[model samples]
Structure formats: C-alpha cells, structure tokens
Target: MIALPFAKSGSQSFLRGDRVHLRAPVGGDYKAWAALRAESRAFLTPWEPLWNEDDLERGAFRLRIRRYQEEAQSGTGYPFFVFRNSDSRLLGGITLGNIRRGVAQCGQIGYWCGVPFAGQGYMTEAIGLVIPFAFEQLRLHRLEAACIPHNKRSTRLLEKAGFQREGLLRSYLKINGLWQDHLLYSLIENDRRSTTNNKGAR
Candidate 1:
C-alpha cells in the first residue's frame, strides 16, 4: 500500500521548497487575497474563469470557506493558500479537486499565483510539494492538469513539475467569459518509479 500523509485539522499544510509555504486560507486572508487578485486582474483573467461580481465579497468568502470545509470533510478537495516563506505574504492558491477514489484514485490539479510572484519558481515549487502529497499521502494514482493553449507560463510550470503532455482538449475550459481550448497533461503513479530512479542518479 502507498504511504499517505493526511492533513491535520484541515487540509494538510507544507512548505514548498525553502522559499514558499502553503497553508489553509483563513478569514483574514480575504483582504489580502482580494487586493492581490485585483492587482493581477488583467494578468490572470485570460486564463481564469470569469469572476462573479460578488466573488470578493465577504459573504462570498464565507460561503467559499464553508464549501471548502465540507469538501475537506468528505475528502473531495484540498485547497491551500500559497505564501512566501520569509514574510508569509499571500501569493495565490493551489487545489486538488474533482477527486475520485476506488480503483482509479485520481484527481485534477489547479493553481494560480499573484502577478508579483509570477515568473519566479513559487508556483512550480508549490505544485511540486502538492503533487507528492496527492500521490504519496492521498494515495491518488493519477493526476490531471489543464491549461489554456496560450498559457505558456502555466504549461512550462506543469512540465517542470513532471506532468506529461497528454492531448489537446478542444474547448475544454471556460475562461474570461468564453470557451477556451486547453492542453491536457497527466501523470500516473507508474511514472513515479522511473522519475524517482532518474532523480536518484542525479
């Protein structure tokens, strides 16, 4: 059986490399999250789904928190807020959603990092930390990720994190008020062994 690490209290938390860390989002984060997301609006909108008018509202945040709590209780999703380890500044978020257990044991991964933190390795490091947690701890057998074709930064980050390009998914996602074509990527547990062996040699 695969060894798995379960989150304590809420979804499990971890430091992403020495530079970044991830923890559950709290009520206090609503302000910081809203500000950063606002600043990065133009930068993020193209690849992200259309935001609801009430998205940043305190009531919306409360509802979101409740939903995340229930999802955590049911083992359906794990959401985490990313931060800079040195200052604990909110950078963005990562989530393992659409989880399926049983023989498949799979989930889909999604993420976003604030504009100021973009182009740095923060997102990549966050993904690296989370994928292992999903595979080793959550006992998820396969992981899937999708990115808009024009999202070069996101595609590159996923590649760096060891996900393989699987196929093109026509109109696979709705973003910025329109349907968008996406490239799908996947990583399976079997690939982990070869990857581990290669890393051991380096």
Candidate 2:
C-alpha cells in the first residue's frame, strides 16, 4: 500500500479546485453533515443504499468518521467532504474507495451532492480535484464509477470527467432496499485531457 502524506496538524492536506476544496471530515463536521443529509434525504435516497432509521444520528456519524479514518490509514480508501472555498460551507462528499494496488492500481469513485447544491457544478469540480489526487498522489492507474442507467445527471458527470462507459452490471448493488443495475464507467491515467483542462484546484 502507498503511504499518504499528511500535514503537521494531523489533518490531511486539502485538494482545492476553482471553487471548492475536498478534505477529510473532522469531528466538528457532524452537525453540518447530518443537517445536509437530513435535508437532502429524499434527493439522495434514490441513488444511495438503504438508510437505517438512525443513519444521520450523531453516534452514526462518529462511527462513520472512525471508519473513514481507518480506511485512510489502511490505504484502502480516501473520503472527502466538499466545501465551498469562499464561505467554507459543506456542499457534498466524494470518495475514492476499494483501492487496489500492484497488478491493478485502481479505485472506485463515488459521490453525492446536497440537494440544493446539485446541478450547480460543485460535484464536477470536486471530481476534477480528486482525479489528480488519485492518479498523482495515490499513484493509482484508473478510477471507476457506476450509476443507475436512468441517472442521466451522474452519467453525464462521469462523461464530462472523461470516464468512458465500459458496460453494465445487472443487479450490481442494493440501492434503497432493492437490487439495481448500473452503468460502469472508467478513466485511466493516460486520459489526462478530461481533468487537466477542467481548471484543477491549486
């Protein structure tokens, strides 16, 4: 596994973009994260796994943070909270998970935006920031994403980010309590054009 560098403060360095920054979620973020998820429940439920009744509770958020940290330390995943650079408000989250190294240097990318922030280009910019971090920082060769076939917004976002439609996975995941098919998409390191011209964060 590759080691990720961290700042002296023990916080992971930020990945900035034109208007957003992606960073690991801290303890203080629980409130905002919970509020946003609560507010966007309906908007996000369709694309996410079935939520438990206490999914957004503080205890659950703490558990999530602990798991995120463990995954980061184990070099198996990197989770980030997207924030507006201007006001530092949480906008959404993007994660690079299931990292595979050696013969297959790749990972899976997944993301979601606050309902109010959806379609405003936040996730696009966030994805742009994460691509380089995955390729250059994490030394991964490819990133893959999957979404329901009817999720035009997600499919378009993947395409805009330079991911090619690879194939379909029948009943790939149980989303919102039922099996759902998904369209697979991928981006390789050689395909720099997709993210390079997107004005990555400094």
Candidate 3:
C-alpha cells in the first residue's frame, strides 16, 4: 500500500479544466460538505444508504477526517471534492474505492452532488480526471461503477466518461435502508485507448 502521508500530500494538488476542478478534501471543507448533506437530505436520502441522525453532527467531522486520512494512507480509496473553477463552489464529491492491487487491479467509483449542482456536468468532469488517475497513477486495470437504475443522471455520467453498461444487479445495494436493484458499468484500459483513438480519428 502507498504511504498515507504520501497520499495526503496530494490533497493539495488539483486537476483543472476550463470549468471544473478536482482536489483532495481539506479539513476546512467539513463544514461545507456536511452542510450540503444537511440541506439536501430529502433530495439525496432516497438514493443513499441509511444515514444516522448523528452522521451530520459537528463532532462527527473528526471521524470523517480520520477516515479520509486512513483511505489516503492505505491507498484503498482517494476521495475528492468537486468545485466549479469560476466561483470555487463545492459541487459534490467522488471517490475511487475498494482498490485492489493484485490480480483484481480494480476499483469502484462512487459520487454524490449537491442538489443545486445536479446537472452542470461537474461530476462527469471529476470522474474523467479520477479515472485517468486510477489507471495511470494507481495502475488499476479496470474501474467499476454502479447506480440505482432510477438514477439516470449517474448512469449518464458513467457512460459519458466511457464506461460500458455491464448489467443489472439485483438487491445489490442498500439505499435509504432498503435493498435495491442497480445497474453496473465498467471501463477497461483498452476501452480508454479506444476512446482516445476514436476521438483522434474523428
């Protein structure tokens, strides 16, 4: 596993495009991240796993900090917060998790966007940057993403980022306290190469 401190050092680094920026989460960001969740509870709850009432408590921020730190250290995950470059507003977050180094050579993608920022293509850009990092920096061979079938937005984002629809998974995830069906998507290294080649051809 990569050293945690080494990973944490990357939090200060960022990826930038004309409209979006992706960077590691900072301690000061807890307030904003938590507030977005608090305000978007209703908009997001139905699509998310059960959240403890205490999940947003001020003191709980420490736990999140620790979790992020551990994730960085172990290389099991890299969590990033998305921002709009124009105004530096936090739009949402995406994570590359469950990273396995050996034969698996894969990781899963997960994300959430604030209700107000739902349709601006920020998440898609974030995923685009992260997937390359997963493949190039992390040396992962494949990446997987799953979304509730009802989440057409997420499905679209995955597709736009070059993931192929793999299939449906029944009772695959627990959302808002209920086991639900999900659609899986994946991208292999070859798929990325093909995409780049196709873009060049066009």
**C-alpha positional error of residue 167 in candidate 2 after TM-score superposition, expressed in Å:** 0.6
The Cα RMSD of model 3 versus the native structure comes to 2.2
TM-score of 3: 0.92
Tens-digit lDDT string for candidate 1 (1-202): 3312333444435546688888767676789988999899889888888999998788999888777766766888888888887987888999988899888899999999889999988888899888888887888989999999888998999898889999999988789989888999998887877899998999
**For all candidates, what are the clash counts?**
2, 2, 1
Best by TM-score: 3
Model 2 score (lDDT): 0.89
Worst 10 residues of 3 by lDDT: 4-13
Superior candidate under lDDT, 2 versus 3:
2
Model 2 C-alpha RMSD vs. true structure (Å) is: 3.5
List, residue by residue over 21-98, the lDDT tens digit for candidate 3.
877777677788898988888988888999987898766877877787788888899887888888878888888888
Q: Give the whole-model CA lDDT for all candidates, comma-separated.
A: 0.84, 0.89, 0.83
- List TM-score per model, in order: 0.91, 0.91, 0.92
List the candidate 3 regions with Cα displacement exceeding 4 Å. 2-12
Q: What is the C-alpha RMSD of each candidate to the true structure, in Å?
A: 3.1, 3.5, 2.2
